[model samples]
Target: MRSLTEQDIRSSFVNCSKGEAKRLAIPRDLDERPWADLDFLGWRDPGAPDRSYLVTERAGRLVGIALRFPSSQRGFLHRSMCSLCLTTHPGNGVSLMTARKAGAAGREGNSVGIYMCTDLACPLYIRGKKVPEAGGRFEETLTTEQQLARMTDNLSAFLDKLHA
Candidate 1:
């Protein structure tokens, strides 16, 4: 992923109105993001914990989506997995993030949801830069490259649904 500016992110949104995009919070650490390690940029709004955002370069263009999720903390004993990166976490570490569909469907309140990292840090988790305290265990035989490809594919599919 490449570093994106506030303007770039605001303009990349496909599911929200221009005015809404302009008003939503953009990450304050854009310049400090590790772009080389990212497949997409995602963050929850500090002002509104239930609100989140994701942006990525797809099919030669930047695409972004606004998301919503439960703000309440989860029980510590349960485990959940991120649909994109497949990293398992204590229940509190995952949330059901939902994105409104692009265009008309979104305007009508239709949305799609999936379990994802609560902090939207799938890239770091997958790259081993951030480790879960519980330690993730994968029984699959795929190599790291294959796992990464799968993650990309899953995200693409999610984006496709948003665009559908």
Candidate 2:
């Protein structure tokens, strides 16, 4: 997998809204599939066990991934980890995600799926990003770069398994 910058990722998303590509949380499965055609790229947010996230990937690299966890409860699903950040949320934060094979991914099976942070805040994690956990803002310990690297490493492993 190749290393990437913020722009390299946001540019591939046709659905970018404001600066949401960084905070809105998109999916890692890049190729487009009709909603009904998609098998594992999305999951019901545990909080709102009915809503799902939108997962996608960046162009020009196998490293960048995103997810859009829905905030509304209107569906059903199982528990899973977000392929990008590797942070597991309860049923509320976890969601199902997947993508199709094409381009360099054609032989990689028709699709790949993963669970993700329902809010899709991986950008912060990718670009030296992080938010204070719970009420521990002033006592936060992990550095931004540390957070980014951990996320990158975890995401890479997740995608690699999919390739295998």
The model with the greatest TM-score is 1
Model 2: per-residue Cα lDDT at residue 161: 53
Clashes of each: 0, 27
Question: What's the distance in Å from true for residue 49, model 2?
Answer: 13
TM agreement with the true structure for every prediction? 0.95, 0.39
lDDT of 1 by residue, 132-155 (tens): 758484657887677778888988
lDDT score at residue 139, model 1, on the 0-100 scale: 59
Model 1 stretches astray by more than 4 angstroms: 135-140
Q: Write the per-residue lDDT of candidate 2 for residues 1-164, one digit (tens) a residue.
A: 22233455555432223354455433343443232322123333354433444333424332333333334453234334456555544445545555443234534335555665665556543332445132112223667556556665665555565445
lDDT scores in order: 0.88, 0.43
Report how far residue 154 has shifted in candidate 2, in Å: 2.4
87, model 1: CA deviation in Å? 0.7
